[model samples]
Target: MWSLFALLLGLVVGSFLNVVIHRIPRKESIAFPPSRCPHCGHPLGPLDLVPVLSYLLLKGRCRYCARPISPRYPLVEALTGGLFLLASRFYPPGVEAFLVFAFLAFLVALSFLDLDTFELPD
Candidate 1:
């Protein structure tokens, strides 16, 4: 069940990554104003907020307004999931795993933001 645990961990991290992605651009506090749709400002229900499956089920559109969702959601979730698998295989639990996980997360976020905004902030 380690894989399942890893997947669950990845999902939680993916949720935080979504917050980071949304806030980093807007210069807002990630902790403030719980997750909401930018287009309609509706707080996401739990079902509407599942990491990758929700996006797929909704066909990548906000349920409240039907606005097209960005592909970044699944991409980040998949990316983190893959990294978790690879990390578990390559490194036992220790500092290396933590470092690698952190690096992988930062890289994913940086690459995605650069691709979307075409500018580097950090």
Candidate 2:
């Protein structure tokens, strides 16, 4: 049960990390602007932002613009979820586990960002 919760939590965090990976390089406010279709700039609603499920249901296309969404979104989400599930199975919940989770998430964001920009953010 706790592992399932960890997976769900990681999925949600990975979705936000997607935003971070895209926005940090551009120096955009990650929080001020909600998730939007990059092509049409349509704001995403709750259903449009349900982590991997939304991407699959949308058929890898933007709901508003019909542009092909990057496969990376679901990939990151699933990766994070899987990582969290694996960690939960191995580590007892506590500060150390929290640090591990945070470090894993930071690594995920940094890796994707570095792939795009080739420069690490401070």
Candidate 3:
């Protein structure tokens, strides 16, 4: 189903969003250093990082450090997945999706940065 495909796509994008959310605030390079746990500095294994399912299974805690995880992880995943489904419903395909996705990503980053740092760098 197209909806299923969109959801899977969203999940992947949401995973990248997690990376962006973590890195952008710290002024770290999003590409390098790889994904790791913020509280424990443990390199997160695949099993520990499966979008919404991982957060649910782990009860929103780091497996390595048992630190309470932020609810933002699942929130981002759900938000992206829902947005994908909604966009697919409203728009056919092509540039509509790309444009909306780009804007959504920017808004997400801006919202988080404003909430956490109270300032927007970019």
Candidate 4:
């Protein structure tokens, strides 16, 4: 049950990470504008925002414009979920595991930023 909780929490956090990865590089506010389709600039609806399930259900295309969605979103969510599950399984319930997860999330966000700008954000 704890592992399941961790996985769900990780997925939620991964979704937020996606927002950060995209907005941080562009110097945009992550919270002001809700998530939108990059290709069409269509604001995503609630149904379009489910972690991995929405991607699969939408056939990896934007519902508004039918543009192909990037696979990275679901991939990151799954990866984070897997990592959280692993952390729960391997580490005793405490701050250490939480720190590890936080560090991993930071690394993941940093990697995404690096990929986008080819430079690390300071």
Q: Which residue pairs collide in model 3, if any?
A: none
lDDT of 2 by residue, 1-122 (tens): 87988899899989999999989999999997898999999999999999999999999999888999999999999999888888998888788877888999999998999899888766
Q: What shift in Å separates residue 59 of candidate 3 from its native position after superposition? A: 1.1
Residue lDDT tens for model 1, 45-109: 99988889999999999999999988888878877877777777777767887787788788877
Q: Can you give the lDDT of residue 97 in candidate 4?
A: 83
Every candidate's lDDT = 0.81, 0.91, 0.81, 0.89
Error of 1 at 114 (Å): 2.1
Candidate 1 accuracy as TM-score: 0.85
Worst 10 residues of 4 by lDDT: 113-122
Between candidates 1 and 2, the one scoring higher on TM-score is: 2
State the lDDT at 84 in candidate 2.
Answer: 85
As a whole number from 0 to 100, the lDDT of residue 17 in candidate 4 is: 91
Model 4 regions more than 4 Å off: none
Error of 2 at 25 (Å): 0.2
Would you list the clashing residue pairs of candidate 4? none
Q: Residues 50-77, candidate 4: write the lDDT tens digits.
A: 9999999999999999989999999888
Candidate 3 lowest-lDDT run of ten: 104-113
| Winner by TM-score | 2
At residue 79, give the lDDT of candidate 4.
82
